[model samples]
Target: MSYRAPWWLPGGNAQTIWAAKCSRRHAGAAPRWRRDRWSTPDGDFIDVDHAVYESRADAPLLVLFHGLEGSSESQYAIAFADFASRNGLAFAVPHFRGCSGELNWAPRAYHSGDHQEIDWLLSRFASLNPARPLIAVGISLGGNALLRWAAEWGEAAARRARAVAAVCSPLDLAAGGHAIGRGFNRQVYTRMFLSTMVPKAMRKWQQFPGLFDRDAMLRARDLYEFDNLFTAPLHGFKNTEDYWARASAKPLLADIRVPALALNALNDPFVPASSLPRQTEVGHHVTLWQPAQGGHVGFPVSHGPLGLPGHVLAMPEAVGAWLLQHC
Candidate 1:
């Protein structure tokens, strides 16, 4: 599970940042996604996109959970969809609360620990496809959520998904938030997140006037600031620190009971390596894949000096290989 960086992209930052850039540039034609609406118990709606392959009649289901502010259209999600479709698997990406390009009616938006949505999706998928195996892959923010969910569910989770894989998750949210606030991360990646997130929150405010404090959200600088101002209050946490403590999955890893794989890069800029859960700390079924290199969700971009496809496709390719052997 040690992912190698492409010869061209050296170090963790280069491997991470440049691979993301390449994925942005060459994700190719957008996949045709079928949008479906589901009613949440909270009186709000969530959007889920389905990508079907014509090749198979009853393919196993692969559920994908995207990063913060990302949707089915994200480059990595598209890559996984392609991988699923071509290999006799069906794919679906669940857009967290308001991230499906539509404003959710509720003032509450998604945070790092929304297990209700995960339960909703899993229950429905299991009901409809009684016999089909279920697999989940969570990336970044979504990855953390999935890991925590698995740990909480323990043996109960094993029945839902045969296997789970988390890629580049901020398992330790406090470390992650601080890491993104410092040095180049603050200037580039953190800024990129806030730029997209602030506008979305603003739109939600406009949609529910007087419900959310738009002024405070707009004044926030990065993830930690935004969470302190908007995310914490909306989600019932006392503050950002409280939210990070309760929401981080690192402490729960030892309890996870389902077959699972958690992947992280030693050089991942967003997730400090020191925060990753050690193998001995996790449950008997969990496996940690700390690839020496492979930035964020840019799996397809490269796979070490061994190198596969030119673009960022190595991730799905590697996952496919793993699934074939293990799942």
Candidate 2:
């Protein structure tokens, strides 16, 4: 069957773009991994693991942020890096706190809208590539953070980065929680997320005995309750509603100044289609892309080595091409 670009992209060229430019078979060559470590303004040492492709010493840089529990090694990240390399673009993917095979300090783990880290990274990038065009592409939770940051920074962020792209993003945290908690999704995703999260929560309790209520933490069954009691409060929000209202990308879509794109699948169980902000609301600064099918961040069928499984996988190249054209 012929490929089709999601409805969000303009024109009919998305298919050709997907096949020729975005294909892993065409993206070319594996990239070498390198780590960039720095201290956050909050006094925490953080590292961003990057894979370089082509000569980036003086070219535009594309910084990628991965999905929940994803690092630079994620298929999407690697594929995007490979695509960037083939297109003569530079690329980097930052490893979220505690995700680079190291535990984070402080009892708290990373949450959506953590822009302080993004600030730390851009400052360094600016020093190196002051004149170089920069684009940020984030997936899933990382995407949510990027969008929130873009909304917060607005034109300042537009001035700092050439463009931003987010795929399979959970624009509304509460809506996403509700969507993911339905049917089989609830069991699969909730269980999987908690399996990874519970341990971290436990570690936090160990570090700050009085900071978190162990009783509530122990009684938590899913991400909603866990985030409501543990994540929101620790992160400075009053509660889950507050956190969701503040952190979700939907609220920030109108504030984006730099050219941006938010792609979500209608069937993505993790993010409700209704949570997506309308194109009219975000103004010309943002483009909304939605395909008929794609499960969460699992756009598995694309023109790649194993053949990208979902339509979501083709987003990076589309974003890269759009950036190249516009920036």
Candidate 3:
């Protein structure tokens, strides 16, 4: 396949490499976000990390989902929570399974299409506190998962949450994956994702010896290969192809009846501009924002006179305000 860099993936994916570099540059800079424990339906206890603003009673609840290889402690996660709290909204950042700083006991790991896990968490939240408005915000891979859930489950998931906002979602996962698989872009993501994922797979192997083909798992460096061998089979998908086919949000967008804000920059380094779905086709339920620049979450905020937050962090506010007005 001859790959043309999506306006997001600049210099034929050199920008993709730079995004990873910037992610590392700002890594570990986020403040300490709190962690909480919740029990799964299977009678397994799982630790879910979250960052909250103020008490849950007075404020509307906003749940956030982080990107690939991200946690509640990610800078955007903390910034969103901070913004929510400052504006009298309460929020929680749910760390994916095994990504919450504690190794999850369950044999399963988190994936972009893991709706059941999110369902379990939301159910718990509703049971504990009812009658409060709930909203969800997701970024990148997290955004993709939320979009898939909304598209697949529709009003069921929408009923549980008032509105959804997804930024930089790889809605067309297959396309996004293929886009990033080119040249140094492939190497950049493969290395970063594998660096974390391989260790986790290794840990799982330690707990359950002979569970995975150790050599094959090690050899799988990119997202597609690793996911096809491990995640797809475990999650009931025939393989990575099946998983990507089912999980990509493009097919489900028309089914989403609830209000949602989908924001992406033409210059985002992950998802290509052409991959962005047409908002008119999504009906009145979706709003698509295509900023000319952001560079895959690298919306640098200027502090000279106008103290505007980076576009990445300011997105929650924009969406939140829009939701309050529309929803």
lDDT value, candidate 3, whole model? 0.70
Question: How do all models score by TM-score?
Answer: 0.92, 0.85, 0.86
Q: Rank the candidates by TM-score, best first.
A: 1, 3, 2
Each prediction's Cα RMSD? 2.6, 5.5, 4.9
Q: Residue 163 lDDT in model 1?
A: 83
Top TM-score prediction, candidate number? 1
Q: Rate the local accuracy (lDDT) of all candidates.
A: 0.80, 0.73, 0.70
Candidate 1 lDDT score relative to the true structure: 0.80
Candidate 2 global CA lDDT score: 0.73
- Candidate 3: tens digits of C-alpha lDDT, residues 222-320: 888888777787677898889888878877788887788788777665788988989766877888887776656544433234432112345455666
| Pairs with backbone N, CA or C atoms under 3 Å apart (clashes), candidate 3 | 8-267, 8-268
Candidate 1 vs candidate 2, lDDT winner: 1
The better-scoring model by lDDT among 1 and 3 is 1
Q: How many clashes (backbone N, Cα, C below 3 Å) per candidate?
A: 9, 8, 2
The total of clashing pairs for model 1 equals 9
- Candidate 2 lDDT by residue in tens digits, 1-327: 112444443332233234323434324556778887776667666677766444756678888888777778666787788778777777787778877777777556678878766766776777777767888888889888998888888888988888888878888888887876677666766777778777777877787787777888787777778888788998888988888788887876898888888887676667777777878888788988887665455444443365443243355666678777657
lDDT of 3 at 45: 65
